[model samples]
Target: MIPATSSTPPLAELRGIGKTYGTGEHAVDALVGADLAIYPGEDMIIEGPSGSGKTTLISILGLLLRATTGSIRIGDREVGQLGERDLPALRAKTFGFVFQGFNLFPALTALENVALAIRMKDGKAKDPEGQARALLERVGLGPRAHHLPADMSGGQKQRVAIARALGGDPPILVGDEPTAALDTKTALSVMELLRGLASEHGRAVVVVTHDPRLERFADRVVRVEDGRIESNLPRLAQAS
Candidate 1:
């Protein structure tokens, strides 16, 4: 796969990673010996059929789940073994998350939603409203700041979600099917915004998706199957 460009260590590193669920006969291997280095300045895409462990890998990388085997290094910290209590704080400081479903608070306005995310990330926001408005404007949602989630279109809501995810300015941005709910044109626009998070903002990005449209924006394409990495190679050329 295309490696990170920086001379320093990777943004996130995984080695000999494996995960299993349950025990004995009921146990199922969900990931196997997955080695990867996600770096800033690159957009990485993980594509595979259902049950390929794509979600599991992202979970481990984002510190939402710990691997049963192997090590995960973020900066100088070996966080693979950190306890659940410690992980939440680290995850809040290190990762920004977006999902297929726009997970915005129903009762909160667009501005309030993003501001809440910012507050959660740092435990304090000097001016949450101002920071939230700026983020909304960045994602093309400034005019919709006062609107509630129900008042916006699917695309608009996702944009608000994106703005919220950026609230922390976390080092790594992880997306699980960020574009799955939108139309072709809207999906492209959302992907464009996601791509900018890597290339423009220099945050490492990893996305798990089935959409081929995302292939163009990716610096590396990884395919997984039956819980193993089938291919971990860079694309010869990206689509237009």
Candidate 2:
């Protein structure tokens, strides 16, 4: 295991970030002058209605999409100017992603899905089956590790997705509407798992969601409207 650094900087920082699509009269600004900071051990929820730029922001933060303007720093590296070739390496080293649909491969079992991600990072043919099993167990999916995604419940699939996201042990975890498809109870369980990843494991977790119940799970809530931040508030001290 890699030793934890005593004085690591913030996991991610975005300054004056802006993203625009198209040109001239057809131009649409998805994000405008947005700025944010995410620190280790922090759970942040970005809340917005449709077209409010929550997805756009997550993409930028995850290094999947570039900002048209402003600077973004992931740890000590400035990613705003990195070439396309450099992004895969940086993404593999620093970030993990969870999607709303779970995005698990149909042919692969839960364990294999996570093992694939671990393999991507280490570039070794060595089986990551044991590591994947440990991760599944951590997320309360130990018994389902050998099951294909189709055999699992909605909540179970999401749990497998979470385990896969953490398989590489990346410092920053980004989720795009992870609970959009779950029932209330299952959604709460997923949120609890994400909270544990941030608070207990010291990962910076950013989630995009419109579910009001998530307000209880987040340390900070950032509301975005019209492609800009409308408000950023820390949950009441007692709430956490």
The weakest ten consecutive residues by lDDT in model 2 span 1-10
Those runs of model 2 whose alpha carbons end farther than 4 Å from true positions after fitting are 1-8, 125-127, 237-240
TM-score of each: 0.93, 0.92
Off by over 4 Å in 1: 1-6, 237-240
lDDT of 1: 0.87
Q: Candidate 1, which ten residues in sequence have the lowest lDDT sum?
A: 1-10
The lDDT of each candidate is 0.87, 0.87
Over 1-240, each residue of candidate 1 has an lDDT whose tens digit, in order, gives 345444757888999999999999999999999998887777899999999999999999998887899999987788955676888888888888999999899999999999998988787668888999999999998899999999999999999998898886788889998898989999998888888878655687788898877788788898989999888777764322
Question: Model 1 residue 33 lDDT?
Answer: 98
